[model samples]
Target: MHDLIEALLLGIIEGITEFLPISSTGHLLIAERWLGHRSDLFNIAIQAGAILAVVLIYRERLWQLAMAFLRPGHAAAMADARVYGQPPREYAYRLAAAFGVTAVLGVLVKKLGFELPTEVAPIAWALLAGAVWMVLAEQLAARRAAVLGERAAITWTVAILVGVAQVVAGVFPGTSRSAATIFVALLAGTTSRAAATEFAFLVGIPTMFAAAAYELVDVVGSGEAAHEDWSALGVAFVASAITAFAAVKWLLRYIQTHRFTVFAVYRAVLGLALLALVPAAD
Candidate 1:
């Protein structure tokens, strides 16, 4: 009963911030530190709840890909499809391309990062960096009015940029997944609303699934009470899913009219507070 309650609390926080310009991982990191929950596995697995939200919301688009993929030549044709006439193959190709780069770089980082056990990844820097990027995003949006268009507006460079940013974001929390990737989209000249939100959803499918899997495996490997805690994890996942569903709906509409300035302010304040609260042990 107690663990169930604790998991729900964490899940609420995760679902709300997962897709927002705010960093879900950052909030989760803080929540775990302060909330007295010692289970990294639970934290990680609940992210799947949020991932499911995106997968379902984009089910139609994803379904299109599923059908196209079972057939051959889908990937090649997608790469050459028109902007206005983009089909599932296009989305699949872009995801594949982005994932390819992300996989190569992410693997190297993980391999090298594991070797350096004493290092901290500067998560605070990630948040502060996000603040700067958000501010710049406002300027970019003002300068351009790029729309989502009939199809995804991602080019090869834009896809690469988003993927690379995710790698950096993977380096630290508080650096929001959406914030970093959106900035790249903005720089690649995507309009604010279109670039910030949808592409965030786009790349998130794989990232969150991978994270959820990693956590689950760890929990099982640790011989923790993960099986016993399935009930608790379920509660947490449902709570997070409900919260995320609402947050995503609200955010898509919010970004349509509002600016990223509000989130930037929040990130700035949160960044400074973390820096002040937890100085080095030295």
Candidate 2:
């Protein structure tokens, strides 16, 4: 009973934070520390369900993608970002590029296992850096109302630039991939609403799916998370999906009137609190 209840609470937490620009990874670490539960692959695997929430929420667009890229008659430049005046798909191409860049860079970094220790300090640095960037992001959001008109199209230049930003995001688990990419979008003249919401879903689609895929591979190869635990996985996933959907809706509404600085500040404070509280072994 305790295990199941703990699973539900953590699932809800993951669902809430996963979509937010604040770091879910950081929150998970904090949860482990505070909950006093032995963390395991079960908690990590629950993210697959959170990922599914995004995919299913945007099922309409994903279906459109199936038609756009898979079918020959679909000439919707909407997917191209360069010519399509419509949102998402135009934005999606940009996201794909960004995800691709991050994937390549992340893979290389994982392979090299660079001399720089994978310490918790980087997470602290990311939280602090993201907070500082949020101040700039607010200014960009205010300016974007007038700016996107002259720069309507999402050009390859912006794609590459956003991609580079994603690479920076990948290096630091607490940086929040959605926050990084959306900041790029907002700075590049996409409206705050469009950039914040679309970038959240668009970049998140591939990013989350890829992460799920990799974890699946790891689980398969090492039996880290068993196929036999599918039932438990399902429970966590459904809870996560419900929570994620609610969180995404709330976040979209919040971004309309609120600047991101509050969340950023929260991340920094939380990061510091964790550093002070958690033992050095962590």
Query: Whole-model lDDT for model 2 versus the true structure?
Result: 0.67
Q: List the residue pairs that clash in candidate 1.
A: none
- All candidates' TM-scores? 0.83, 0.81
- Per-residue lDDT of candidate 1, residues 1-282 (tens digit): 777778789889988998888888778767766566546666665787888877877776666566677854654465533322445566567767776677777878877854311112355566777888889776765666644332236667777878888877777767787888877776675554554467657777886677567667767788885445777778888888888888888887887777789988888888877777665511
Model 2: what TM-score? 0.81
lDDT of 1: 0.71
Candidate 2 regions with alpha-carbon error over 4 angstroms: 36-44, 71-92, 114-122, 144-152, 226-232, 275-282
For this target, which candidate reaches the highest TM-score against the unseen true structure? 1
